[model samples]
Target chain A: MQTNISVDLGGTNVRCALVDENGTILSIVKGSSNPEKGAQAIVDKIESLIKQLDNYEQANAIGIVVPGLIDQEKGIITAANNLPKLIDYPLKKQLEQDLGKPVILANDVKAAAYGEAISGAGKEHAIVYYISISTGIGGAAVIDQKLLSGFHGFAGEVGNVIVDPHYEAIGIMNAGAAEALGSGTAIIRIGKEKLGQQIEHAGNVFDLAKQNQKEAQEIVEQMTDHLSTLLSTIALVIDPSIIILGGGVMKGKDVFLEALDQKFHAKIFDAMRDIRIEEAQLEEPGIVGAAMLAQQSVSH
Target chain B: MQTNISVDLGGTNVRCALVDENGTILSIVKGSSNPEKGAQAIVDKIESLIKQLDNYEQANAIGIVVPGLIDQEKGIITAANNLPKLIDYPLKKQLEQDLGKPVILANDVKAAAYGEAISGAGKEHAIVYYISISTGIGGAAVIDQKLLSGFHGFAGEVGNVIVDPHYEAIGIMNAGAAEALGSGTAIIRIGKEKLGQQIEHAGNVFDLAKQNQKEAQEIVEQMTDHLSTLLSTIALVIDPSIIILGGGVMKGKDVFLEALDQKFHAKIFDAMRDIRIEEAQLEEPGIVGAAMLAQQSVSH
Candidate 1:
């Protein structure tokens, strides 16, 4: 019966909601986070946004999900480009004091994974791995409805996973990182090279490929192979009951989903070829999962 | 207060031991399993070995660890190349009935990971990942002492994980599998081609490298770089507190461990640079882990 106020905090906007046990948002308020206004102002804006929730007072705890790395054990945002000024700030402690309630902070992807594992596509499975392919790629594993919080809250940072040691090297990331080779950013980058045009978005590449453009189709196939290698490698390591795919890349799922599945199965041992990869079912998994994470943490 | 019988069943030998609460081997016996003599013969051999233990009747349960795939949920050995005849046998039920105790079967790498996490090099860590570089590479992740058993029992089959989509291809494994690139078999394979000699063992290559053989050193470096890529990729996926290395390849640890660590750190994000890689500290992790698994399962 526990209820929670979940906030999906991103650079551009933040959504505060009151969530019930079934991951339904009971009441919600949304507004620009304006992280550029600096730490204290953004924090105050979040507090006001929470107060605007129709059933805010009924919430048992607050859970804020962020898009960047968090020093979870220390209750600080270690690195976030949008909220740079808040980096290393005692966000958890500061928010808890102002709200007068227990608070939980989780990585956005991890929270989404937890949400899906408990109430969405992964509800029937005990081991669920969630992968998000957007401008960049990220992932999280939810085992028995609990997120795999790595030693430093890096358990699901699969975007940086190296797919090949010899292929391509980008700044900071090693050559052939999954994010470098298969993410939305990678699609656009590869698209420009092959099509000799300013390909603005990954969707365009998918559309072109769907329209039977040989160049775009090659890029899509390249991305598919890169993802297949990454997924197959992760599957070997963790062996999730199911892997749920979400993110901007899923917009192109119709173009690449079947190919991705076939390529993934071809890479792993036959016994593991059955590990299902499906599109995420929740429309607002980040907020819902944040709420579930708070509810679970407080109840336990 | 619980005690159990742990059996490390390999194609070559079987070691049975009475394990006490602290993972101590109270009593032990070892001999060839003679798997070729057939499934029933091996089963009989195991039962006889258990009987040879000083306190066989005191065990509350039995845990057997095998090298190949298992249908852990069904308690069946699904595929073990060495014991081909026992592929679909009801090994767990047969053993339980014969020994009159509850039985649990686990993959060897997974059991070794449990052993290390429970009482060996990884005892102090909550998330322990074990990677063994033997004839082929295998790995397992033990989070809070429980192995991450995949949908089937293929969770720790890292050897078959493809490292690159375009590297050299082998039999059933996809092109550029971790085993094909970095295992002892790979080392010997690469050494033979470069040094123009039948390199009998990976250790000989390491020995020659130590003696300043240029071709051998290059092979060692190649293997080291492949391992670094593999480990760095894995670190991003799971972010374990500690990674314990075992298997026959560790015999050449002096030649490659330091370089492997340096290369591994170089490839990962700065935040994960501190993750430790250490040699496994168990003389017999297979038997010890199998025992701990039985003890934990029954108590739960």
Candidate 2:
């Protein structure tokens, strides 16, 4: 019956939830992160948001998930793009001091992977790799019920892996990065360039591909092929029991799923060819995973 | 104080050694695998080789490391090209019965990585990735003192990862595979094709590159660049504490080390830019690693 507070700290907003031991959210609260104001201000806002919950004081622990590099052992945000001020900031210590409770901090994607590994589509699998093909691709891996945070908590950054060395670079990402080739933003950009018109999102390209438009189909095929390359590389290296695919780009999965599966199977090593690729089941893996971490932390 | 038997099963030879608990080889025995003769014949040769050792009965356990796919849990060589007759053969069970001792099984590269992780350059780090850029590139990852054997034990098959979609395919490897670009075999093949002369080995290309030969330098640069891509992909995905580079390619490392490091650093993610890449230290990691696994099996 114990409760824990879970917070999904994003660049634009902070989502707080009071979740029980079983990962059920008893209550929820949300507020603007106001990143332009700075890190401490956002922390203060998170505090205020949590205060809105009637049972905040009763929670045994608090978990916070954030985008960007995190020093898990030190509970510091090492490098956050949107919340740059939080770099090397001891967010967990600050939150613990204010909340008067234990705190667990992790990368947002890793937390989501843990959530999926514990109770979602990957629950039955011992090794789970969760990839979110959203605005930009991101990934996380959970092995034996624990997230594999490499030397600096950077494990499972699969999107950064190059799929084509000749492709144009996107922002900080290198040329031919899986993100630049397969992510939602990449799809839309390629779609616009090919159609000679404005395309609002990746779904438009998927729709065109489904209609058998040559240019759109080629673009979609490239995207899926690059994604397959990334997936096969992951399979060759990690060979997880299951890979759970999610994120906004998957909304139009019907157009690419079968093609992706075929391409991935074709490229993967013989020994790892059988790994199942499935869709992520949890709707709020971030919040639930944060809560799961909090619960596990307290139990340990 | 106790000893274990280690066997390195390759396509060309069967190497057996009696190693102490600390991985010190107390006695050695080697023999031709005569692979074309069949699996049982190879097994018999291996057994006879072990019997030739004076410490055969004194060994507590046995560890076998193989090149192709292995069912480690069941101790079977599922599909080995050289030992095709061993397909689905219960090598571990048979070895245990013949040796009258416990047995452990693992992939050769994985065993080498475990050996390095336990006592080589990677001993200082918790996560270690060992890559052997030899005739055909191969890789293995050790996390927390254990090799990461994926669902079907295909973890760390990095050479199969495609680096270029447009490149010509080599043998069973897909087009643009890291193996096709960076492996020692690839270097020789490309050197002969470009030089229009019979280049004996990869060393000739390095020797030419060191002398600032344009074509040779280009070939070496391409190899190093592809290696950098592979290493960067590994860093982004696994973010190991340290990466250990080994195999025949390292013999010509002086020609490519600095350039490889630069290329790898340039492509790796910002958070993972500091990962240290080092050389493999173990002189006989295969035998030592097999022995280590043997000792661990009994201890477990």
Q: Which ten residues in a row have the lowest lDDT in candidate 2 chain A?
A: A268-277
Fraction of true A-B contacts recovered by candidate 2: 0.86
Where does the lowest 10-residue lDDT sum fall in candidate 1 chain A? A164-173
Candidate DockQ values, in order, are 0.77, 0.75
Best by TM-score: 1
Residue A238 of model 2 has an lDDT of: 88
Error of 2 at B227 (Å): 1.2
Cα lDDT of model 1 by residue, B1-300, tens digit: 568999988889998999987888888899998988988999999999999998789888899999887787789888788888889999999998887899999888888888988999998888888999999898888988777877776677888876665686877777988889899999988888888676889998999999999989999988888888888878888898788999999999999999999998998788887799999998989889999999888889
lDDT of 2 by residue, B1-300 (tens): 798899988888898999887777888888998888877898899999999988589888898888777887778888776778777878888878877899988777888888888878888899899998888887888888877887878788888989888898888898899999899989999999997576889999999888998999999989888999999998888889789998888999899988998999899876677788888888888888989988887886
Error of 1 at A204 (Å): 2.3
Compose the digit string of candidate 2's lDDT tens values, residues A31-142.
Answer: 8898888878988999999999987899999999888777878998887788887888889999999889999897778888888888788998988899999987888878
